[model samples]
Target: MSQPKARRSQLISTYGIGGLFPSSTTSYMIAGLHEWKEDRAEPLSEPRLARSLKVVALKQPPAGGRKDVPVIRFPYTQVCPSCRRIGRLHELSKDWNIAECSKDKQPLNPFRLILACRRGHIDEFPYFQWLHRGQGKAGSDHLMKLEARGRTSSLADLVLTCTCGVENRNLDGAIGPLADFGTCRGSRPWLGPETEACEEIPRVLQRGASNVWYPAVRSSISIPPYSEALSKFVDRHWPLLADREVVTPALLARVAELSDGKYSVDQIVAELDRRRGEEQEEDDLSEARLRSGEYSALIEGRDEEDIDADFVCLPRDVPADFDRLITDVRKVTRLREVRALYGFSRLEGAGGSESNLCPLAPTHTNWLPAIQVIGEGIFMAFDRDELARWADKSFAKDRARMLKVAADRNAEEYGHAPKHIDIVEVAIHTLAHVIIDQLSLDAGYPAAALRERLYVDDNMAGLLIYTASSDSAGSLGGVAAMAETDRLGNALAEGLVRLSWCSSDPVCIESKGAGSDALNLAACHACVLVPETSCEKSNSFLDRALLFGTRDGGNESEGIFSHFVASAVGA
Candidate 1:
């Protein structure tokens, strides 16, 4: 038989015909590298061999994969043994291709090339030999011995060992898998680099096969009731997940430890939720994209105040029976405890309160139009005909207060007080008759679950009153009083009708029209809206002055108008 190739080992020494080549086994290599077990859950390419290998070429730089984002990628060229041929690989049966290598480790300059090749055949290439000492009859052996007794090299495909003791074909890949060996060497041996070297002497070569690729003992992050494929996925991602901030390594280890050997999805999810509200939750190392304008506020997993309203954390397990998991999740996570997060208000400059309608001038300005929009949005979202039964009953308990808040806000923004007949009122009125249905939630939710956490900012609750009024044209103080009075009117309009009203300051009129002529009648929802006052009580000086702005015009009728309104009111 052709001499088997040497098993993957650091050559302690080397020699040639003249004398011998200087030694090149490494300090680090002699120390030994960490073992990585192959993902056996992945379907095996071959089921006959208990050993396969992965090799890499250290000379060639990575093509494109090694970048800012950390992703595990296979390289395409490498150094090997016996010949100068690169450990050629034919991924997916596409024509044979050169394996990839890196420059970080020289002796391993071939890197993981052979390890990537599942089949046992080394591609046609010269291998940079790692040689060791040998003895000859004269005294010392001058050259490395080539012992091919009678067998020739065959073109048969290569095979490998998996973590589960399965000998599978490693055909289209460069990474070889690790599996348990039966009887240490009892199973059928596949051809590999020679592991025997002058056993009569210093025992130069290692005695038997080793668990190459990845070592098989990982006590964390497993998908229950293992299938080869899912185990592989779990195996690959679990180590990476260990470093993630939000998905704590300890949490992963906990699941790995708790299940004895298998973890269910519910267990994983429960652990995740426990870790979520913690101040030291881990961050996702992977660059998973989020919404636009969503800032990096969840750095250590806690909001500024130690909580967040956005996305809920869930376990990172893939259970085949997810439907059942959902049932369990519902019981574990209460629906009432759900709350949608509140980051949108960051874009809204007025802070998170409805108390201040005008960020610029809270007390005197009435931004009813804005309040109206908010009301409309509220109605569309929560006031549908079939909604009350499903509405959060807790929120329903404070429904009246919610309306009052909206109204107070509307009055402040629009310069008019609000009434109980606005858009929001109309919508909630629609919801008043509907019944709640707890079963409707049984259907999978198409909407995000936001009720897990909600918060209102404490900064937007006060008034920054901006007032412009005519006190007394006769003096600045008089002008100031008149201006303040005018502002109060605007606030009422905003709070009541949800409309913007131009300032009704009579100061805008000419000096000739100063007293009564400057006043103009403005019709509002069938009633004449001027300064607030009694209809027939024009007897008061303030009422007369305010009504001066709402009388119908250029007439003997002007004088006749007030008297007629007064008599009509009395009647």
Candidate 2:
């Protein structure tokens, strides 16, 4: 059999360890990280990302050469399309080259349904139990067969039967809350013969369901100093400087000399101290802390562009039309972003309990799978004073409170931490989406290829809209070119105008709560919602009413951007 192939980047973003993918022959699941051969894969160095994940290093997914990332057959059960005889792959296959039914000599297809739990365990559906309803015991000689009535495409039309004189049953109620597929055995097939005791009830799911796998990826942008030549050199020799007992002034001086005097001993010492300080503050290193560094580097632009540097930023004048609402603009000509896969979750979003997270490796490993993409972006910082005043408005407060109530309810129902919904965050997030939608038309990239990063907090209100891909198209500079004063001003004005009315209006404009978990108001696909990949919050916490005034029952409420829109239209 020919080994299947996948891009190294896909391993981290879409199909990491334990993810399922279909090949020409059959479906397979990526093996656990332990099966990956170290020599076939190369190591990657991203200090901030490594520290955030609490790992010593990162590695690319194994590719090329003789051996690559390993995979294992999934759904063990295969059904003969002709005779409807069901059995394990080994039983049906005459040999490795042929997987034909033993009785009818027909090609076998993998069972469409599998069992999974919220705790990330997966197993083959218990056909025997479903056939007899746990009333009959199956012997080695017993055989099970699946028969479809061909009446409809629903599970109620599919029936499972056993050779024993036991009653058969349909597959109805196997996918919903009424399902009695039984408790999970905690099977971790990707990790070999390992099983843990679990009480989570397994739910029946199609092999290709989107909710089957959700990679918990954490990414960081390479910013100034960190993306500088000095930083790269220091990272290359990190092990030597990391050891305090072996380090000395002589070693520092020798390292400085090796740099051809491009860097001084004092500079190396400062960088080392900075890394040590980061290690000491590891506990305080949250997502906000990570973005804070990027925010500062972006707002305080660097003009000296080193051709070889991974990141380069130049401050641009804010468009005069938007100057009152926008504080600053930075055109990111060159940028590198590193994304690492820490873990994954099944049957839900990645924000659930730690116990629900599936390990990438069977045992502790010092490294994680990661990929880096180079891209260009445009960063815009909003006026803090103006935003603060808007957030204080009674209507904005009421809207925020309504979203918070919905978020609280969603958190309680989904078993995840509640999101802190603030008016400023929502308005900024919505603005990012609206602009991204507009940029997709003017910018060269499609909406899915573009991405948004929000920097919102007590002291920060900004967003970076960039297209980062593992391919060369990521650096086309189309996005950054839009940062030009006139272009950006026109884009902003057009975006607000487009969002002022939605195709799903009055329902859309009057929507008090909409979207998943009712976390949005006056926002839908026709207006502000963008692709899930483009949004940081999964398209949540958005309200066009907050950007443009709402009219409910003849009472008008002015929005934060209503004045700007009015001024642009000469209203």
Candidate 3:
């Protein structure tokens, strides 16, 4: 069969291993990492990412190679469009060459519904079991058919029938908790011929449901020291030094000699030491630590003579009009972001339990799939002292407590970890959304293409609005250009103005809570919410009321930027 093409980045984000994609003929799931031909894939060096994921190395997905990613046909049951007869694809077809109706020769369509469990096991729907309902034994001889009575486009109109004279069943009760699809067989088809014993009940889902596949991706921005030439050179040659029992002066001298005097022996030795120190500093790296490194780099800025370094930032003056609210601005003219996929889960959100996450390969693999995107961005730091005072306000605490209550309830209901809600984080996050919405219009990038990175904690108050693309070597400076005093001031002003009044006003702003699980307050699609891809927290914990205070009858509570907005309006 001819293989379909996918972008190298998509293999990690959209269609990584075990992910299902549709071809012209049928749908197929990407095979496990064990099936991938490593030679066709290029090696990617991202030590921080490897350490965070606890993997030895990373590799870019193969594209335009002699061999491509392997795939296995999914939802093996194929239904004849003409006769409505349903059976396994292998049984319906005479051989691998043909996949059409055996009797009518009509093209076959894959059964839309499949079974999955919280544990990430998936299997074809138990058709024989459902058709027989345990009344009698079912076998290959008993032909089954799926008939859709075109009366209404509902599952109730869809019927599954068997030739054994058992009572037919409709698909009405086949999808939810009441589903009798039976226990999961723990099938790991992507890894090939693997099935385990599972006791969890399987839920029926459409083949293309969003919850069917959620790739747990971890990303880090290449910053300072790490982005420098000498550091990168060490990263490339570390495997050589790493294999040795010890890095002696002789080995260091040889490595420096191989550089042909481009780097001094002292510089190489220092870079290697730094790398080793970072590895030894922590056994498990956290996301906060990764962002902390990037935050420091952006704040200090970097102007390298090499010009080809992965990261280059130039500090810019804060817009005069918004200087009180904004502290610093950095124009990141060049940046590289590395994203690696560690594992994936089915029927769960990105924060599912580690035990439930399916393996990328049949066994432990040292390398993971990753991709790097180069781009530019505008990083703006808020006045931390001012933010701290604002977060201490009674109204800010109340609003934050409300959102925290919602988040805690959501966590309890969903069985996920409770979210840590900081009033400063909420305001900064909402500000990031409003600014991203404005930057989308001014920066020449769609909201989806633009992404936000929030730096809000006890010590840091900032956000980075950046656009990265794997297809381009670097960005066109649209985002970074907006960091200029005049453009950025206008963008911030316009963003504040836009947030002052949502189109869904009163109802939207007055609401105690809104959005998924009521985890948001005074925020919705009509106002602060951006594309899922653009947001870090899935558009949760946002409250425009926190940015521009809310009024209830005679009482008004001031927000973080309420004074700025009031002064701008000459109130």
Candidate 4:
């Protein structure tokens, strides 16, 4: 969420969603969601979700563990100060990481130049254009050298020359609007032979800078496992289902006839009916399901037998305050999640057009880089009556208004406002962060692995925080174990206590608006914010005061967890 300065391409191996794989480190495009759908025609027994679904090269898993991924390193740009000779130090050594520059037995220094554009196009400094400038005298075999004139490291002091001894332009004014790098070659070396078309003029960027690269990622939760056996069967038999034009009764009968006893028409019709019903339910605003069908599971669903089980509710002895505020606590032992990587943006903030996923080639490509993670989580459903009453309060309304204004302004700038979560969601999200921070200390899991999934809509208000990984087998029971009745009560108390008084309190509690976009009211890095991976909203719309109280004159009475705080003191 926080765009800290660092070498982006290098760090992806260690921190990307698909954890440190070779493809993630260098490439911009990862697999998309739709690509992961059933593709059985390839004749592979076990599915290869990452490779077969991608557009470019097959992203094979590393043969070994972390040791397998090649160390991310680049050769130094060697330049001759006396003769204006320019080349990569790799020419002197076999390994680029350890290479040094030597020309005429004299050691050469590295060039501090790189080229990039506002459109996210990046490339090497155009030494050829800087030295030759379309002149016929210099040929491919010409020896190039570079010279720096003064002690002050300025571009004007840097000079370029060739073996031909022709006068070459100094590095001065080389980065201006009129200076030449030529029409961007649209090169994407990261994708291994892939290229793109870009008309942007390239600019200068120091190597290993944070602005060099930024990734765009989106995620979704797997809900209810398709809700029928026949639907699942059809999905698996996509080859048989692929050519079907529509899902009408006649088509189902024809498909059943064609299946030759593989599938029954009655079962197919039932499955189609179930799907249509679900779609209709989605359109009906009165019963709009919350994102991921989590509301359905929270309201009425039983646990399944295995790790991919949909929902399991465990009744627990809630604290007096919790009894008044929370309606149910469900320990979700297993859930499916789909994450897609569409495209990337550079320099500017990451709000690319939604249409960037169009086919790069003439023919269709069913592949996109994707990985599946199975994780366990805890879901807490707030008491609808209590939340509705709170929403009616003037203070809550005013607070929501403040957030709405901030959201509107953000939408104007970013082209889309964050999905508006009301006061109840704000309270739930703030509490979620509070719990995540405390859980990291006690749950034996890093905050990075513990992610938050918010469910807030007109009909439902809930929060689910879980541990997910790209690894085939998901997390240990470190996070989900905290959902035990006594353990959860204790963790809830501890989290509430932590939020009652932040280390940056007074300032942290009092601030009306703080954080990256001024989107937060009373939250700060000292307390409320967690790692970007854990939060859905990028740590926005958070306010500790909503859970506790404002700094100036607010007290426990003004907050949602006032009863909890009071009961904890009584104990």
Superposed model 1: Cα runs more than 4 Å off: 1-137, 152-210, 215-571
Ten contiguous residues minimizing lDDT sum, candidate 3: 552-561
| Tens digit of per-residue lDDT, candidate 3, span 1-571 | 5568889988998888888888776888999999998878887767887888888787898889644898888879888888998889877877654678778887778888898888888889877677687677444468789899999977789898987677788888677642455577889899899698988888888888988899988898998777877877787788777754677788888988888889988898778777887788966888888888778889999886676588988988888878888888999888889989988998877773667888988889989999998889999998899888878878888888998899888888867778888989989999999988998888878888888998878888889988877654248889999988889888988888767888898899898989988989999889999999888888888999988888774224487777677777774
The alpha-carbon deviation from the true structure for residue 122 of candidate 4, after best TM-score superposition, in angstroms, is 4.0
Model 2, position 257: C-alpha lDDT score: 93
Q: Which candidate is the best by TM-score?
A: 3
Greater-lDDT candidate between 1 and 4: 4
Write candidate 4's Cα lDDT for 344-401 as tens digits: 5554444433332233222445443333466877878888678889778776777788
lDDT (tens digit, per residue) of candidate 1 on 226-246: 112323233334433434565
Candidate 4 deviates by what RMSD?
8.3
Q: Report residue 515 deviation for candidate 2 (angstroms).
A: 1.3
Q: What is the Å distance of residue 269 in model 3 from its true position?
A: 3.5
TM-score of model number 2 = 0.92
Q: Poorest 10 consecutive residues of model 1 by lDDT?
A: 370-379
